[model samples]
Target chain A: MSTVLLEEEMTDTPAAPARLLSAGPAAPGQEAAWEQFTKIPLPTRTDERWRFANVKDLDLSPYLQPQPVDETTREELLARSRGLEKAAGRMVFANDQLLSREVLSESLTRLGVVWLPLEQALVEYPDLLQQYFMREEAILGGQKFAALHASQVRTGMLLFVPRGIEIDLPVEAFHWLHGANSSCFPHTLIIAEERAKVTVVDYYESADTNAPGLACAVNDLWLGAGAQVTYVCAQNWSREALAFQINATVVGRDAQARSLFAQLGGRHVRSESVSHLRGPGGRSDMLALTVADNAQEVDARTFQIHEAPNTSSDLLYKNSLDDAARTIFSGLIRVDPGAQMTDAYQKVRNLLLSDDAEANSAPGLEIEADNVRCTHGATSGQIEQEELFYLMSRGISKRAAQKLIVNGFLQEVIERLDQPEIGARLAEMVQAKFAAHR
Target chain B: MSSLKIQDLHVRIGEKEIIRGLTLEIPKGEVHAIMGPNGSGKSTLSKAIGGHPDYTITSGDVLLDGVSILGMEPDERARQGLFLAFQYPMEIPGVSNANFLRAALNSRQSEGEEIEAVDFYEHLYEEMDKLEMRREFTSRAVNEGFSGGEKKRNEILQMAMLKPKYAILDETDSGLDIDALKIVSAGVNAQRGPNIGCLVITHYQRLLDYIVPDVVHVMVDGRIVRNGPKELALELEEKGYDFIKDALAEPVSA
Candidate 1:
């Protein structure tokens, strides 16, 4: 591992040149786009959304393309990635290299379904990949990181479901970052055509807690007319790592989409998620849960856009902060002029476990449609004293009681996913993170 | 040697004295009843003895097995063999009863030692059966949406599992109908043994009828005015609390 770290350290010096050459495989039309990405500036302290955030901590200088590990380490990570024993298919990647892939049933694959790695998908389905790749720009101030991700990403999964087909079980993807200052770009693109239904889970984790790495990831979901899609992402990067993820979902007429983001790790992390209810009767649900402890900081921003009549969207984000950790949630819901009957709701709840911990929430709604129903709220509070007393009276220690209450508070958002297996696994992971902090 | 001793305990809440120099000793192998009207500080004494932070113990001490526990935290006090069955149990949303009870038991274990899951479940199921609780109740959130009777029974179920040396039942009979009272009392009676002491607090003497006490103490104005055998509860029930209050007034006036 030290040898690999040494090699990664040496490669970090020429990162910019390596990134430029990495973009050589892009199609002709993407050449100008890649150049445009190079011209974009990185986020700085002057940026409003980046204020209060430690911009100096956003150092990408020491990270390099992670080197592959031995078969023994790969096997160990593969065994650890075994979550949700009943998953439809499981794919494990170590150091941005695919270690194993469990193929789905033939019947499901025959229904015009495509479940393959991003590299393989790029070679086999170039046209399909081109249509959705980086189509929706990072409007939430992560453009530089998003561009850097597009230029360097090599390990990810693509799920393409043809018209009118529904996959009952969810597909799973795991991306593990190993070695010091290792960088990984995990990309997931899911396209469900007319009347199709599908679910996908993208899990991010690190090989060890001491490794300082970077994860710049993107997930794009395109739901066609009358389609339904559910996407869940659990980000459990190492505590010494930095992570940035941008997610965008486009919903067509009568289509429904639900997405959940679980952030249980990362020393400094920022996530931006946007949902575009583009056509009539489209609906989207955006849910997030974050557990920030120690000196970690988690910044999350979200947007819901009702572009057509009868569109609806609901967003809920919950955070539990301990020690000197901090969390910021900024969300907005917008209803267009012609989007009559638009229904949107946004809520952010923060549970503070320490006097020094901080939680900042900003919730906003703009409704141009006269008949729209929109509500947004943000609340920050410590665990109720009476509730703590109730648990303590039952013989639970103060520390254990606080953990239980926080878990219960966050379970509301997890339960909203309506997938029992995934909810349980996510809860376990969150509990594990809490235990580590203790 | 199992016993709970309260020595002239004076507790206050916001500068107002609730338990004024009240003392009581309950030894193992016996059941004691403290009957009083509302605002008589019966609940305050129980909470103070259990080491609740909100209830300030201005004077005196609480002891378990002759060991002082007044300086310990509530959970530490509990681990020292003291338990307080709350009058109004709180509703904890999204935390299953099984998990809550497991945490409580886990807290009692030595550091870095874990409870055996199979044995824990077996003990839990046995206690639930004695309390007449359904198996499905284990999965429900702790006391969330539980009826008054269910909450009291759940408290008894916890007492059974914890097997405390001394347990204080504060208003355990309040809001319970004849059927629920019988069920709850039966659960309590089943736990009564030579190893455990019980202090049952109630306004009415009806609860004593089922889990008949060995001694009956009449508490009024934050002090125990009279102490006697089991028949005393029957006498008090026949003649209401006013008889005791009027009787005590005459002596004070003289």
Candidate 2:
């Protein structure tokens, strides 16, 4: 497998044959959207949404859409795509191409569920795709990239849980960027109808940590009236790669939606997450954890919008920075005028491991509603000396003690997920990342 | 083989000397109690010997089993079989007591050696039973939100689990009630043997009633001025530290 991957690296030819945008049996309205993508200018630092970002890295000339891999590389990737022991369904994609799909149980299909690749779903359920695809605007920025994703994204998962159905196990999707200078745009759109319940996990990882690549990803979640949905996105890109992920969630009347974003490995990552409580008695929980080391920079932005009466939303983001790493967290909670009796909270905590590392937090709130309760806070601090002393007094070396404390800091966010297996796995992965740096 | 010897140890925080040339020796097969007044540097001596960074060892040496541990780090000193039961144990928010103890034990092993999970749990349960600690305490974060007595008991529990050669209990009886003091002392007494040496630093002799020491020393102005058998503690308890200070005022012959 290594020999085949090495052979592919030696070849200078483009991995995938660039299909001339010939009007070959185009999907009805997609062509116009594709045309719109070509017209939209790439984002620049001048744009308010792209402020404080390294816009020069937005150049897309060197990254080509990668082609499908040979059998050996494909088998190797499939072998490594394993995740949790019991997943409802699993799909593996390599270099923007589907490699394997496994529907573990027939019960899921019989329950009126639609879990398939985006292209297949588009062909079979175009109306459903049209009703939900890109429905929630990229309000937190990444509009141009969202447009590009809409134009070029061809492989991902589209999950639809019908009304009154609940899938107990989580659905898993894996996206791998294989070659150097490769770019993959992965999209996940999930809609849970009234009284429906489901959980979905998306894993973004690179084949090699030092390989340069670009990952432009987007996920949209819609919870119907009285539905409950939990989504988790674990991003572990290579050290030399650049990643951008935009997530938008809409919660309906009497519904609950919780989303966790775990940023484990990325050279330079910018994630924008937004939750909209659009119906009465709706609730949304937004949680994120990031461990940044070396020269990595993780920029995260979040928004909690209460648009209806008696709604609640909470957002928590925790980051641990070491060496010369950097992290920025900007979050806002906005309650509309009609969102009376609303409850909203936002908190950002940063644990700095090195004196030279930097963390910037900006928390804001704008409420036009009456009888509402809201609070927002941001804190950046080093590990308490007493806490370190406590650990060292127990025979743990200073380095190991620091690592444990940092892990404990991030574990608080992971623990809030209420899923033991997932929380333990994430903690282990974060600890492994810390150990590798040592 | 296990002993702690402090010779003319002068410790300071910045320019102010706290422990002014103190000297004491505790050997294995014995438990020694250091009784002092409130501001007499009993806690400072314990911390200084454990290599606390804030307390500077100005001009003396602390030897553990004939090896000077003045230059070692706190953790290295711990690995060398020295333990300091803190007066106020720190609250580590998210690290469970079980994992914390496991890490300490893991550090004693060579590189790449792993602790067997089943055996670790068995050992932990046995130690918890000895300390009368609940199994649930294993899941709780170390000293977080624990009551005063609970924290002291937790300190003793850790001392028992680590099985150190020389254990320094600094004010372990400070906030504990009488009942809790007995329980905590029982845990300490259970570990007393020829292989372990204990230095119990306290302000009152009340704790000595439970964990009866083999030797008792009166400390004043950061120095041990008198040393005797267990009866010395009872004498100090009745006469108080002032009487001991008056006696130490007399000049000593060479």
Candidate 3:
């Protein structure tokens, strides 16, 4: 319905071989990780971490491993990969195969910042890839999915910002699932050396609106001492697709890392994020916004670990649920025994727009140090009737009024991003998503 | 040529009737004031005319420009050029005052028709200057964390930008100080012209001093008991509301 065309359906074509992964020889850790992935049992409702989640949807037997996309389909996806107007660099991938790559500027390259596809980076900078690739496991209960991603993720971006250098513009990556009943494993690993600053945006989309697909993604962000990094993940799969996004962040001394996860599409999505403030004076800000409509379900889990003194972590997640949609948020913050002066906070707010919509939130905090400050809270409610009446009294239609209120509710998180261009782009995406429902 | 006519309007909250058989009319190019004591249904009358969901009109009708709006929703009534300046304006978080006013104006336009940014900002800045509102106020949330005076000024700002055919000021002077009262009165006075009519509701005669209504009506119970010219407001101020109460208590000659 939107002017942003994704792809057209092509029927009656014989299915291609699906088990041929494009990734090269896996490292020792990745090999063992894949073995464990095959051995680890699928999650059940009995698991505490997956409580209240629809675990029955985790069956991936019907979805074949990604197959090589046809040239025509690949060209169509490449043409449809529209995003930020200008970026430091951009990469487009479909079905876990690199379709296109735009190299960085000469100035950036001279400064020793390497922005390469994961496969290329594995061959060119093997030492860096081996040291940081999947180094921090998914501790928020997506270990099996993370292992699968490690084994199959051949298409993504590896951005390495060397010491004392800063990139003014953000780098971008687009991952598309092209075929029906296919799966894509997209990984983004970023390492910002001491005093470096960089930002990366990852966009996950489907080529067909009605096709059923699976997307398993992992983003590992490593910030060296005094480094700063901002990472944004915008997931917009097809309506029938299922998605799992696992993210891990490790902040070093005096480093600052901010990450925003925006969930706007998909039939069912489960996101897990973990931030570890491993050094003194390190700061981590975790923000997420979910707009769930229809019968879709979104479940989010997060962990903030304070392992050193003078560390701080703040987390805020907001969801707007409409129709019979459902959302679940479970987050925890823990401070180690010696991590004194640790400041941590977690808050989740769910706005229910329809009578049948539902939200479940569980927030927890564990503090062992004596001088730490930790707080966590969750709230679920409907839009204020008075506010609704106020807008309606001004001659705005009820639907438009609700849209404005929802935008206002989610705008706070976007404003916190402090990057106006990126914020505006996200808002437009929100608008497009809402338009699709209409 | 146009008028807001409320004919024998009886409004209620749940089962208890508030405005009992109130009838009034304010044609274009006139300012009418309704002065009453506490619980005299002055606010209820304005709300009923504005199609507030809380107060339902049990009988009679509210006609805007000769068209009965009894069955219309609040937004529909609003789009028909009926504006209510609330006594306690609601605060909408994260919705900028500029955007709120723009939406109000935009709702009056035809489909796919957008207000030009150049003209909108020019007109908005002109009105803000008249209301003594700061430039930054436009970007702030609608009346959120605003003082009582600021909120009233914002309501006036909306009225100016919306340019409604008929405006209802329901107790707009209740929380305003003397200075704020003067500023708000100036804003209303600036908007006074042959194209607009107004109904100002107040508890005290003090507001009538600044706005200087052309006609003043006194309501004691649920009905307007007396109607007169501007001099009546001065008389009420000198004698207090007790004069009306005493006058009503006297037995009528059959």
lDDT of 2 by residue, A243-328 (tens): 88989999999999999999988788989999999999999999999999998888898889999999999888999998998888
Winning model by DockQ? 2
Error of 1 at B222 (Å): 2.1
> lDDT score, residue A332, model 3?
92
TM-scores for chain A over all candidates: 0.92, 0.92, 0.94
Question: What digit string (tens of lDDT, one per residue) describes model 3 on residues A1-438?
Answer: 111212322223446545423332244546776777787888999999998899998887767677767668877998898878878888888888777777657699888998888877877999998899988978878888887887767668899999999998989999999788888989999999999999899999999988999899999999999999999999999988989999999999999999999999889999999999998999999999999999889999999999999999999899999999999999999999989999998989899999999999989888899998998999998998778877887898888888888988898888878888888889989999988886
DockQ scores for all predicted structures: 0.64, 0.75, 0.71
TM-score, candidate 3, is: 0.94
- Expressed as tens digits, the lDDT of each residue in A198-233 for candidate 1 is 888889999998788889889999999999999999
RMSD after CA superposition, every candidate: 4.1, 3.7, 4.2
Stretches of candidate 3 off by over 4 Å are A1-15, A19-30, B249-254
Kindly list the per-residue Cα lDDT of model 3 for residues B70-140, writing each as its tens digit: 89988898898989999999988777888888888888889989899889999999999999999999888
Among all candidates shown, the one with the greatest lDDT: 3
Which stretches in model 1 have alpha-carbon errors above 4 Å? Answer: A1-33, A66-73, B234-239, B249-254
Runs off by more than 4 Å, candidate 2: A1-47, B250-254
Per-model C-alpha lDDT, please? 0.86, 0.86, 0.87
Docking class of 3: medium
Give the per-residue lDDT digits (tens) of candidate 1, residues B1-254.
46788888789998999888787889998899998878989998987887777889889877799999988888888887788888998888888999999998888899988789999999999989888899998989889999999999999999998889899999999989999999999999998999999999999888999999999988988888888898999899899888999888511100
True contacts kept of each: 0.58, 0.65, 0.60
